[model samples]
Target: MTMDGALARIIRSAADRAAAAEPEVCDLCAAPVAEEHPHLYDTGAAEVRCVCRPCSVLFAEDGAGEGRHLLVPRRRLRLPPVDTAVLGVPVGLVFFVPRSDGTVTAQGPSPAGAMRWEVDASAWQRLTATFPQLASMAPEVEALLVNTARGPRAHWIVPIDDCFRMVALVRREWRGLSGGGRVWPAVERFFAELTERP
Candidate 1:
């Protein structure tokens, strides 16, 4: 066969292999799903979809789906907290976001907007290394939340959506490093919240 024909055959074969790999039921509709299917995130309705390409592309345009729907980013960012040798954050737990504007924004989130702060590379390194997953965090959607309250506690693998909750809890309830009584309760509550999620 000619080169163009060979390439077309190869593409078709790949598509066939993918089709052979799907589960029987559609994850969303429970209608029978073929192995070859597209995945979509409904930004307007906040839904995940296992759809045919036509349905997946329906919402592909900018500001589609009433502007509420956002595709669930398929890519995962691995961001670990970097070390902070300078201006050690008074509290151990802090969330750091490296913004698109080339600014490293740090905060713990409070009732107010993110109680903004910044840290140098050393501190960032210390925190990120402990939580390697933070290194690949998606901008605006996630952050590296680090806890060094009493010499570095275990890092929590949390969703970007949940970082604000951590900040609000820390700001409102934290009294001291032991997080005082108020802080511990909030931490427990946050922990419980994580456990309940799938």
Candidate 2:
């Protein structure tokens, strides 16, 4: 083949490779999964895993692998506004993760990611007591996602992955210093879509 033809062939091959989507495999079982798949929160690793149905079902009710892996729930809840002064989260968007020790960690999304913030243990307990729904959240795998970025603040009991998605959104949209104006609307849209999800 001529030199020009060889270059064209190489370029075409590269394009073909780029167009081929990589198969998403289950982290637990290594099975190929669909675009939208169940995810599990590996407590042992403190990370999330994209998994197939069967592998996720193993921890559906939680407490599988000696409580090492917990299935992330799909439950979504829109909670009424409540007093959160106790938690003292500095940011407008926060996600609270429950611990096995009966304490909840107050965290907020930033350009960095989901960041843990300090809260009074007694006050957190009181807040949870005031809201039984908060107390009942599935430990480790679910989070109370609170959004106060815009007026008429909203609160939702969201999946842990949803919280991570919000973290990712903020990380992606954030600009230098004051987190550019675009970030808030994007944050709003994120919650709006979550609200619309069935």
Candidate 3:
């Protein structure tokens, strides 16, 4: 092939690679966003969206844009140990997701998927009264993540997306009926890193 044709082919290949490797852009304004950038939760449809800094700012407040766009906060608070027994569930890793209707749902990871466990209302009331922080959790966008795989007291108040991410990780790494060995270590590492987040 001619030198010009060969050079053009090389340029095209390089461009293709660059395009393929492009970073994820904000869904709102199409601005380039980093891997660790902010995210938005569409409450109306229960969807998570990647967003840039400015778009996040625009919808930082609750009920922004007719209550459709809710900015996901970056708060990662280490909470005191909670009693899983009181919640009517076995001692294990679980997360509490609050709905807008003033009800909270308890869910945990399993080989099949996220499994819901029945919770006692009186027990939930007692726990929430003990921790006032639980009362302030963002509705539909934040969750109380309790990691008891190691032991009790490994609780955190994290973004709602983190809950889904944890569910995904467990479902992905889980193996056979026993859950194999890798799942526990990954869970430990995840909580460790989560605790260390700024």
Candidate 4:
């Protein structure tokens, strides 16, 4: 079967199982999955799917599935200095990812939910020039997550799933206008863990 076809089947199977409230399984093989497992982003669906290590390895090449499915890379880097003020996000944290339509999307966690806005193309180009690493981001699958909420502002190139997960975290923990008392600490711990990962 074509790779995309196989991936679609796996995603469908996993979704069916999830609907039944069963344990999470590999989207490709239906094997039981660990609490923490590799994921791929479906560009068409704008969703992340859990897959077995074997399946993940299949798509690990620099470009896989011809843009249908993108294996989320584990590489994380500390971004070079760049101005966040230009993005105009009210929140201290925001993530930028490229869309299939050639536009850049800027999103961040908010008390209501994930907030999104279209980033100007010229501005995006400037960012890529300033931080050359931005040029390597896998379109539609990887994101540049920036956290300026606390001391030592940080930037990371993370999977799109990770950015959405952080959005969920903020939505769940946010309180009042300032994001409750626990939100910042939780965010710190999350980044700390990421930094510790090998």
lDDT of 1 at 172: 84
lDDT of prediction 2: 0.81
Q: Write candidate 4's Cα lDDT for 1-198 as tens digits.
A: 999999999999989978998977887888988887899888778778899888898888866778788888766777665686776657678899987677888997888877889988888888788878888887788788888878567888887878878888888888888877989988887777665132
Across residues 1-198, which tens digit of lDDT does each residue of candidate 1 receive?
A: 999999999999889968897555544456666665545444344344566555546656655555444333333233234454343566555666654444466676444435667766565555556655655664443455566654334344444445655766767886655456677667656654453222
Per-residue CA lDDT of model 2 for 1-198, tens digit only, reads 999999999999878867896677899778999888998887777788899988877776634667877788888888888678668777778888888776778788788877896567788778878998887788887888888767558888888988888888999999988899889889888877876243
Task: Report the C-alpha displacement of residue 79, candidate 1, in angstroms.
Answer: 8.9
Query: Comparing candidate 3 with candidate 4, which one achieves the higher TM-score?
Result: 3
**TM-score versus the correct structure, for each prediction:** 0.45, 0.84, 0.80, 0.79
Q: Worst 10-residue stretch by lDDT in candidate 3?
A: 146-155
For model 1, give the 10-residue run with minimal summed lDDT.
70-79
Model 4: residues with Cα > 4 Å off, grouped in runs: 1-23, 61-66, 196-198
